[model samples]
Target: MGLKSFLSRPLAAYVAHQYQKWALHPEAAQQRVLQELLRLGPATAFGRDHDLAAARTAPDFQQRVPVRDYEALSPYIERIKQGERDVLWPGQPLYLAKTSGTTSGAKYIPITKDSIGNHINGAKDALLHYVHRTGKPQFLDGKLIFLSGSPELEQVAGIHTGRLSGIANHHVPGYLRRNQLPSYQTNVIDDWEQKLDHIVDETLGQPMTLISGIPPWVQMYFDRLTERTGRPVGEVFPQFQLFVYGGVNFEPYRRKLLDSIGRPVDTLELFPASEGFFAFQDEPGNPGLLLLADAGIYYEFIPAERFFEPNPPRLTLAEVELDRNYALVVSSNAGLWGYSVGDTVRFVSLRPHRVLVTGRIKHFLSAFGEHVIGEEVEQTLREALQQFPEAEVVEFTVAPRVSDTATEPSRHEWLVEFARPPHNAAAFAAALDAGLRRRNVYYDDLLRGNILAPLQLTPLPAGAFQRYMKSQGKLGGQNKVPRLSNDRVLADGLLRA
Candidate 1:
């Protein structure tokens, strides 16, 4: 190997060694983490200790806590909204991550110092492990780019001071903090539209080797970059080597991004939220993400088979079966104990403890009582796309809507966009319908009764989702397209001419 490759090999080896050591002894690592959580706070620690103790004593400790939705925690969330300090934890929270959740409106998720540290450490582990696997030098010895949410600190009565993304940004090492692009002091909050334009314009010619953000916003930024430079994105910023994305799935937009850049780029998916950075894709070739089990968070999974049941057992990492879908529940250092964030995941393998995100538990449609899930929809789309190689769905939303004419009381509508006019829209829809029916029997019955009409293939004008996002004041920074819509109002608004 050459000098640069030789130097990187040893670093890669070191990272791999660490990852292997952790993987081999996850229980030991979690036990040590439990001790640390105890040190953080008695109540914070006591909750976990109680659960563990309960698990040890109960016939099936994993089955004790029923699968709960966010509604279960609404009362506590309301207490936080009312300015209560110790509602979730012992002391005043350090910050709140303002996230625009589906339908429930904006939620100010509390984040404490311990939780912040967990996020940082989890990220560090992921990065170190990556360097070890690839043996690639950290391209930017300079600044790192993190296209994050608005850093506006909320000043609500009794609410925390710091914004989630901003607080995380602030926690970066003092020396590296200055290297952050878009200095935190700029009033990028007041004029979001102008700010996005400025961010795109200013960074056009910079030596930014790494870019990270949500997929939708990144696409918008690239679109703007291409417009501004009057050249393809790759020509404007050829040096960018790595793109790190988190908070949403990037699979659907992968091809578009590759086309824009003119070449394949290294992409890393991070499983992070306001709660904590739970996992990351350890190696580019790995099938599932490696969980940061050592982070100050305890994880549980509700098996897919029991997901809709009134009370589904919550299995720990060890108790969970491999290759089955499960709803993720987390008890973190952020004071969220036995919390179900609504995201769904499945284990691709168990020996290495790697997991793949299947879908959001709440983002499914089962109006026919068939229990259709996000994974089923994703799989159906994947199969349909493979059959019709000429067609590409730019954006889509699936929902149960009744026909206004009352002929079909219950029918499913899919608002979809194609790259260009399909050779046969009807055939494409039929293929999708067949795929769905085969994968989910309930959908088949619904289709037979015309309860679910032939999937409506609506061709969205180019940049339609982008335009919608801009109108919603979420043009840039960590915002993504709504993958599934249950309500008719938002769906109709999105579909309207």
Candidate 2:
């Protein structure tokens, strides 16, 4: 038997056993995690500053450490980068996970040994749960291709620095590393387009059972693969069983990615950021992904509608109600305390603490009180794609078009790059406009009053978004199109690109 087959069965069984204990008693799991964080709190500088060493309970901890974001925590991060010890975490960080400067400029999120453990093992445990629940362990016996960034890290102020994906990819166990496709040498190719070509060449002949990447890049790789092989993905790798993805909401790309994959495969969604690996798909019957309450992270939630309150109420796992949108706050082993990661999520289950990533708390287009979110735009786009079954939108962004002249009333401009252009482009745009009308009351009212023009579809060339990302040095790894911007910066920039 192969090494993966020989080792996977016991691993899956153990993960299943552990998952049951965590899922059935989420509140208890969370409580334990909080207690652990509180224990570790005293050793670091942040803990002493907040009197975390003496803080005995969750209430005491909450009273001392308020909710903060990267801006608030920037000083500590800078200190850590300057070779300071026990600034955020217990000591100097092993690395700085460089997140794409989207909402905030490029953020160097600290990654300690403890935080990296959560990043790696959390994903592993989630996959193990999948294997245990599905009664399928054979997929684990084959090569698992992780479409990630360069593993070669640069030393910055004695701290290794690179993409979080790269750091995590560097740490894969020797056994799994053997099963992982694409050479480390090839994986480090900085140019994303060139990297993708090398990946396509390396993995095309492997026994690929599982593949993981952000959606747009996966679609790009799949298109290249299909064109080269003249075969569907299912035919190419008949044993391919799962597609694991994250970085952006999957609804818009679901049909397109599925079409490229050429068959239905069990898909798992992950909510991992540079800060920490937070949540993952656990159970089939359950509604959102199961929150990792027991992972090396303590979480708090603020209702999204009221997140702007001067002192918004922060709810713990036990306090978060089902079906309400909440902005996530986290205090992790990496030394971030009560930091809002900017993403908003809706809980689907309270029992196991499952959640759906709804939208970004900071990302929205409300130029005319339309209050449109990434989720809404993506939903509209998904529904619009239904009218043109043959066409697929690879990547897209939206901007509000406010006009000075009477000829152009304020409206939304969609800069969409199609993987497969629709047969009738006008019909596709109309369907998209109709979708927004149905989904958004403000949009519908604007249309009814003729205060808004029909949604403008500026169809972009294929790989337009990729080229823009490349030019910006953000071609891959958790970077994505900003879906709903209030200004025309992205649209205008894409035009130039």
Tens-digit per-residue lDDT, 53-155, candidate 2: 8787778888999898777888888888888898877878989987643223457899897888889987887788777778766777888989876788998
- Assess every candidate by TM-score: 0.67, 0.74
**Window of ten residues with lowest summed lDDT in model 1:** 53-62
Candidate 1 colliding pairs:
12-132
Scored against the true structure, residue 270 in model 1 reaches a CA lDDT of 82
Residue 73, model 1: Cα distance from true site in angstroms? 1.6
- Candidate 1 displacement at residue 269 in angstroms: 0.8
What's the TM for model 2? 0.74
Q: Write model 1 residue lDDT over 382-491, tens digit each, in one string.
A: 88888878877777777766433323334567777666555888887788788777766445644653345567666677777777778788878998666555446556
